[model samples]
Target: MKLTPFLAAAAAILIASCGGSNDALDGPSGPAMGGGAGAAGSAGGGTGGAGGTSEPQDAGDSGEDGSNPDAPPGKTAEEACKTYVGAYCSQLGKCSPIYLQLIWKDAAACEASLVPVCVKSLGLPDTAKTPEFTASCGEAIGALDCSSFMGRKVPASCNPPTGPRADGAACGEDGQCANGYCATPLDQACGTCASRAAEDQDCDRDDDCAFGLICSKDNKCTPYVAKGGGCDENHPCEPGLSCKGAVGPTKGSCTDPAGPGQACDTQQIALPGCDLNAGYFCHLVTHVCQKMDLSQAGEACGVVNNGYSACTQSSMCKTNGGMSGTCLAPANSGDACDLVDGPYCVPPLRCVGNVCTELDPAGCK
Candidate 1:
């Protein structure tokens, strides 16, 4: 955003009043902290307050504090302008042409806050004649304004004119349409025909169907596949059945085929397809095929006794000896000193002797 001249003047006055004693504020005998020049030595002894400087602790130390060093001095108009403008600009994440509008509108406000730093850094007799500050501010504003419309698409005026338009021909703004039927004023190319399958079922690949169902095969709209039903290569089964291992080579099988009391005793019988309604191959006492609840059966067979949920990422799952499960994090993440990189608990219970303790605090309880 740009700072107004009035705001800049006010800012310069405010900053000058606040930092009128920069010369009195001592610094170490070295370059200024923010790459400026100042006398060496400490402002005061011992620990200084925030934004304050103390005695030189080291040789390479520059006493420039984190506060803005580029501020202008005195209660001049230019100093005020720079102060407000710089502060507002710092808040903007990125610089662009639109920012110039802001700069122009808010120049005065920024100057009120920034002039003091400018005066200290520039050593201007008066704020108005500070060429360095003027050049910097102008360049910053100009750069943003020039680059404002870089990625925007060219307007329709740049396009070649077409012959007399038809009744319902493709049109964008009111200027392009013949009878105004398609003169819709949208942000981008407007007035376009709507797609046909706006209400059709969602589908990815094929094969998510029964014997009778056939996918429209159209990229846009495909037939819906019920949960646990046979689907084509493109369509996917419900939540549990991912596309990768559905049936064939890269196919998936249900670990639990039979219902509760059925037997799963057959080497040939693989796990059921992702489609639970189609049926499942239960793991009875003998490894044979027995129809069962594919969803529940898969969950029951997959779960570890320790109550850890199955997750795709190895980091999410933790395995120790024969017992494996998901890792748990302490309630207060910051307070817990035993946290690992991903917040998992460290193994073992407690430490021995006078050495530091290294054990799972949760497991001990």
Candidate 2:
């Protein structure tokens, strides 16, 4: 079965809801420089970061160990992704966060799972057997981001050629509604344009409720509770609201999750309380919920008691430097990386790169 972009995007959302950061990304390290002739079947112009393979050069293209020892160590993951993924989708007549989210999953496995599917769907040679393909895949895959993809609109290319239906008109999908979403009234197969329902109005989906209101457990629109107001998983507050307390029948009150300089739970080791959606995370030293600063390649990271705050989420600060160190990309085979807590190498490739490589590996085993 051909997987649609919508399916890929939905999978990303599912993975995120299961309690994972959808915002995993390799910090931008700028595009690679250097050039040879363009290759055949290239997705975008054979630019520095826009990786693509040339015509079959040898048996390597037949699907064996997909490693391009010859391919220039072009741009890092972040650089290549910023160039191609967006361009590839736009060229295919679809460009939006929906597709972007699908391209960049919350973790390496999530992102890797989609690579083969994307290669096959796009008709590219199996990258595993082709060095050129591998080069393109690495960069394009590395630069995926969760924050950038949220709340993005479906591009006009993906929408029905005919404009959306008017309110009260029968609809089956979000694209069919004039407002870009369908609201099920009475649980019918054919929904209608989700007019924002006022307080106490019937509602089946959150979008059906008017601004400042949310759908309660009883499926009725209710005003969103402010700070200290009662709240739970089902009954959520406005954008910045965070329901505290333990998960169960009762959560807690809706309050400001965190502010720019306030303390927060970044690693989520504390209370699982901070709203990650708001970009709130406890900084290593301060443990405050503030936007993290991105550390570029070779920058100091992993300061003492800083909780790896100095490094970007994707890169790791070398372990040798106790208090401060350089932020470098995850090591490959026989390369150096942190073995202490959670090693950052892509799965199957163990933390100690020299120790293990996927021998007879299949799937994410």
Candidate 3:
């Protein structure tokens, strides 16, 4: 039977599952199977049927040979299969049952030739719970037999288990928690039930604490207690009020003291005083004040002051410096000398051998 159609159908299924993004199989034709039929036929020339090939061997054909140089040393057959399958799947984009069967056949042929690592790598576990391998050689050659492979059966954990826990708790061994257990130092028990505590829990660091709390140095959960009265580091008070130590020595409270000419109205408690110099209002919440006019501040102050333009506001000049002035260009002197803040300077002030000289208005002095 032609296998090309089957291969195409399988490939199409995989491509569809992948959102039909692959353009490699866009051609009008499918893979030709008869091309390799002759090679297999020659290998089985002595057989009766046309296009016949020697019968593929079963797992029992090759017994374990620990000391055999032709077999992979210190490696299990399933492990080898995982490595080979991973490599093959990387090239094929996806692993299919047929690909596994082909790999098994190829591994068997290599084993018969006494190729080292081939047989041991392809051998399946005898205690496989499922009939992973099919009886038909053709069917077996093109199928993934994962029933006996440990990597396929218990894929969550390999020989040495390590990964995230399914229950959202730390794990260390198979017995720690139930599903998807991972080995970790914190969770010594392999499958111990984890607790959802708000405080005094086993935590590696502060980041493990709840949303508003932090892990303390003693491994306890502590709320972000702000200092001075209001919002602590965790429960920050709104803008205009700062977290300060309250009446008690250890407690904190959010409060805003009334400024000069300002009333102690609770509603306007967070309102900031107007900076006559800077022309900006300070945000009590973040303790940061903003300028109202940045261009004037830039011109009066400097271009690179605090990443803000000095001319942002006219008041910035009065606050930043005692000088209340606008930007001005210096007057020019004809001696190639630097200009200074002045109305005008004498002309024809040429540099004579490094000495500046001002020409007499009448002619030369």
Q: List runs of model 3 lying over 4 Å from the truth.
A: 1-197, 202-206, 216-219, 223-241, 246-249, 255-288, 291-304, 307-365
User: Tens digit of lDDT per residue, candidate 3, span 146-230?
Assistant: 2112011111112111112345543322222223122211101112223222555644332233222333334564443322444
Q: Which prediction has the highest lDDT against the true structure? A: 2
* Per-residue lDDT of 166 in model 3: 44
- Candidate 1 lDDT over residue span 127-155, tens digit each: 12232333333333333321121111111
TM-score of each: 0.19, 0.31, 0.19
- Say which candidate scores most in TM-score: 2
Residue 275 C-alpha lDDT in model 3: 23
Candidate 2, lDDT over the whole model: 0.31
For residues 28-93, could you state the per-residue lDDT of candidate 2 as single tens digits? 110000010110101110000110000000111312222334444555433333333333333212
Error of 3 at 178 (Å): 7.0
Angstrom error of the Cα, residue 86, model 3: value is 34
Model 2: lowest-lDDT 10 consecutive positions: 48-57
Rate residue 188 of model 3 by lDDT.
Answer: 14
Clashing pairs in 2: 66-128, 263-288, 264-288, 264-289, 266-282, 284-306
Report the Cα lDDT for residue 142, model 2.
32
